[model samples]
Target: MMTCIVIDDEPLARSLLAQHIADVPFLEHRGSFKNALLAADFLSKNQVDVLFLDIQMPKLTGIDFLKSLQHPPKVIFTTAYREYAVESYELQAHDYLLKPITFERFFTAVSRLQVATPKVIETPIPETATTPEHIFVHVNKKHIKVILEDVTYIESIKDYLKIHTTKETLVIKERISHFIEQLPNPPFIRVHRSYIVNRDHITAFTQQDIEIGDIEIPIGGTYKEEVLNILKAP
Candidate 1:
């Protein structure tokens, strides 16, 4: 279960979120606050997994409050303004929900939180064994196993990632960095800031871009030399 709190100035909004939280079987609504200050104070003494926060408020805004925390919980911004969407993602918010949030949208955001939440594997690891060749990605609340060898590339879209595999494309609300950590070297290389291509899938390459299965991926200026070196290696 994920413990959560709502920080919104509007009473109706708070009530709605509280109700929504109650409806979700995996979510536990801890408390609701009128402002970020109160929420911050409460957070100091409590352990929370998710925060449903409003963008605009008196005393301190949700964005400012989130910045104040040295280590903030997974935040799902709840606001009426759409302009704050980019800024919210820049802060690595789990998800953003515009005002008048419906149950479906709320459920989607919470589902993402569940998928992104790191799980501890109790089994001990063998030191000599190499990293696994596949990973399990959460999509639509389900964990789907994906083989790294079958992946053509990965694309970043705002708060989500599109995993392009040989068979299909899987979309998930996760960071590219997360995949980079899982994908082993040599086969997977970050060719661009918004893309990571599988080296084994590459059909052709130039200094500026790489061609993989009829798709051409641009090579970022920073990654050019490394990409060329890797591809040209004997």
Candidate 2:
């Protein structure tokens, strides 16, 4: 079992991560701290396998704290900001999870740490059978239910996202990358840094862009290879 701890300045964030760690079968929750300093003291004495750490904090940032350690445990940075993604990976962080994290995304990250064990391999479930059909987004002080099948594409606007569905467009305070975690990948794919399109809604595509109805979304150069490969596959 991997022993883990959460270190975040937000009480709610810490609580949420602790709960997620508890829900996972392979992870054991060791402790939760409000700051990296408190966690550093605990780490001096105990052996921790992983750390769910927040990037922005009061005195010391998560990145700085990890740099100070001579032998730091594998860290998974949890924060609201996406700017530090490159630096986090440079630190050899196990994962970088955005705020408003869902259980599905959290599980996907932690499952990478699971040890391989010989077992009967089972056939994968079909997308129609297993893909989540809907997601609730906090909008207008209410949790609005959005049918995944209705979403044509998602566009990033500053710190918010404009979710365009067949029925209407809903703007919400969330990062597109963070919101993508709630949707399954086969039907939902990020074609650009600012956009994610549902393959089901895509009517046509080229080397540079994709067409969904009358709307045309650019395929970012960085994402071009993977996007073409997935779209071209049988």
Best by lDDT: 1
lDDT of 2 by residue, 1-234 (tens): 788999999999988999999899889999999998999999999988888999999999999999899888778899999999867754657678999999999998887645221233498756677777898999999999999999999998767999999999999997554566567989899888789999999999999999998999999875798899999988
Among these predicted structures, which one has the highest TM-score?
1
Residue-pair clashes, model 1 = 0
TM-score of each: 0.64, 0.53
Clashing pairs in 1: none
Report every candidate's CA lDDT.
0.87, 0.86
lDDT of 1 by residue, 10-83 (tens): 99999999999999999999999999989988989998999999999998999999989988988999999999
Q: Looking at candidate 2, what is the lDDT of residue 161?
A: 94
